[model samples]
Target: MRSLLFGVIAITILGLTSCQESAKKTPEFYKDTVTFDLLSDMKSLLDENADKITIDDVNNLNGAIRYYSPIKDSLIGKTIGELIEGQKQRTLSTNINLTQATAFSTLFTQSLKFNISEFQKIEQENGQPLNVPTYQFQNISGKSIVKLSGVVDYYNGEQLIKRFTIEIDKEIPADKTLNQPYPYNHDAKNQRDVFVRDNFDKLRKVWIPTMIEFADGKIYKRNPDKKGENQLDKDAK
Candidate 1:
């Protein structure tokens, strides 16, 4: 009887540990993967409308496209005029203008720009030196951003050194400057300084906004796979 009780207790503990490990491996959200067929359709529409559409128009359409089965099927072979009309009709019926939603997202993203001002060495309460990076975000889009999340890739000359995801849930008012420190702190000032100095040239392109949320509850998300050459650039030609 004593041996059986001990065995059951050990099994229960191992089961709980296994469950916790499995939970940790699960992601908070899955990637919104775009299909190759959808990409081909988007390219087809752009090629068909090359002479008729502006870059902004293309951007709006790119933002408006959805990967869901029904919507994706409907947009497979649409002309420029057909695309615009469809967007309008869908907006009227669903009360959601994907194009407009995308436009707002683009506006908010383009409005905010960031630059690392300097690296400071501060003494902590424990009398240890901490190296913190001072950075500034300038919002010029005349609209406030409620939340923003993205990946910041730090490069040394041409080689990638560090990549980290940054999230700001606080309200950032339009035409205002927000000064904040990088979330990471280093113990060695010399190492931090060397990394910063090497990555200065690529600083401007470091911030790639993956998602943006406005005060009105509209959210915009960028496809992770399409990093440097986004749909706009691919379709513009």
Candidate 2:
């Protein structure tokens, strides 16, 4: 099927590392497989509010957008208004807009576009010592309206942290054959643009973590605050 997602955004997957000695002691919570059936939820939501609501009906539609920081000479942060303003002001070139816009509400009701789970482990960082394994879902389809991307966070030797989805892109071609789940016309001028910017941090804070199961038979349940920030040693537990 031609994916509802118009384009594929490639995220660099880090190479695999040998299962460390600490990894051998992986927690019992992560021993079993867990899955978050977002497709089912999306379907339920669509069915419940069929012909009734748009993306505006729901609340807390958290998301972010990548933009180049002229001062730093790099793409440093995600902000919708800043990005738009930068483009409008001619300070940033329009050729740089990589992905479209995504709203969290519309993302919750779509099916994944393609197979994307070959690698899931993220290498340990400085402050966050434990290697984190993540499950991701991208380029969803359904209703032919909105597409979304997803990530599920899991600790190396503990439980999960967050399972959330974000919008894929702002602009979607008008499909008269397809049902428009959201009231807005995605093809309209600046209609799909972000209304409020600078909410990326707020989105992270307000996002409620959920449980998820991977096809590989590993289950993950959210364990918020189990380990303090910058706590690294897995054996100390």
Candidate 3:
């Protein structure tokens, strides 16, 4: 009887030890993963919710232009023949190319929040319509990201739309310069860089709606005033 009792106790101790070892434990370093749930009110633009919001309440850049649909579109009596060669071509090149009226956009975001910080105002002007002062913060997750509330323009050449983009105010880890995409030809490389830079700039045109709120009080929305290409320009020197 005494031997049996000792054997049972030993088995119980071993089982408990095995149970502890079997449970998976997260690495200590994982404690530093940022966990702030703070995010922009994205549904404002998605939900079929009626258009109670004004032109400024939300960005209108998405689906602004259907890309690469038309080839050549000309006005009446202004066919390519008279516009190009002196001869009056017989049949119309129905290929009249007209710019589409919509485009698409996607924004990657990083959420950020903190225990305390100073109040800041929102403003938009010139080509870059964004200004949010950096505020100090302490987070429980130990990972800190900058809070930047901004908007970008969605455009394809002549077509333009406004997309509201919110970010943690840090360069994306995987972001690469547009000019770095694989290529060998010299002239092609130059043209490719131009295309990439234009695309990048088109990603920066943001429109400030009538009113928005932040750490401060009510704020006014503003869009960049510009002519020329009628688009934003972004390229690193």
Question: How accurate locally, in lDDT, is each candidate?
Answer: 0.60, 0.28, 0.29
Clashes of each: 0, 14, 18
> Model 1: residues >4 Å from true position, as ranges?
1-109, 125-128, 187-205, 228-237
State the RMSD for candidate 1: 25.4
Cα RMSD to the true fold for all candidates: 25.4, 32.1, 28.3
Provide the lowest-lDDT 10-residue window in model 1.
228-237
| Candidate 2 whole-model C-alpha lDDT, 0 to 1 | 0.28
Question: What's the candidate order when arranged by decreasing TM-score?
Answer: 1, 2, 3
TM-score, prediction 2: 0.16
List, residue by residue over 1-237, the lDDT tens digit for candidate 2: 345333332211211223344344433321222123422254564456444433322221111112232335232332323333344444223222211112222223232332223322222343322222122333233223233223333222343333334333332322222111211111212321121111212222222222222233222232333321111123321
In candidate 2, stretches whose alpha carbon ends up further than 4 angstroms from where it belongs are 1-110, 113-141, 145-151, 161-167, 170-237
- Span of ten consecutive residues with least summed lDDT in model 3: 98-107
Off by over 4 Å in 3: 1-150, 161-164, 167-206, 209-211, 214-216, 219-237
Using TM-score as the measure, the top candidate is 1
RMSD of 2: 32.1
Worst 10 residues of 2 by lDDT: 191-200
Q: Compared with the true structure, what per-residue lDDT tens digits does model 3 show for residues 48-104? A: 433332332223212111111142322223321222222212112211211110110
lDDT winner, 1 or 2: 1
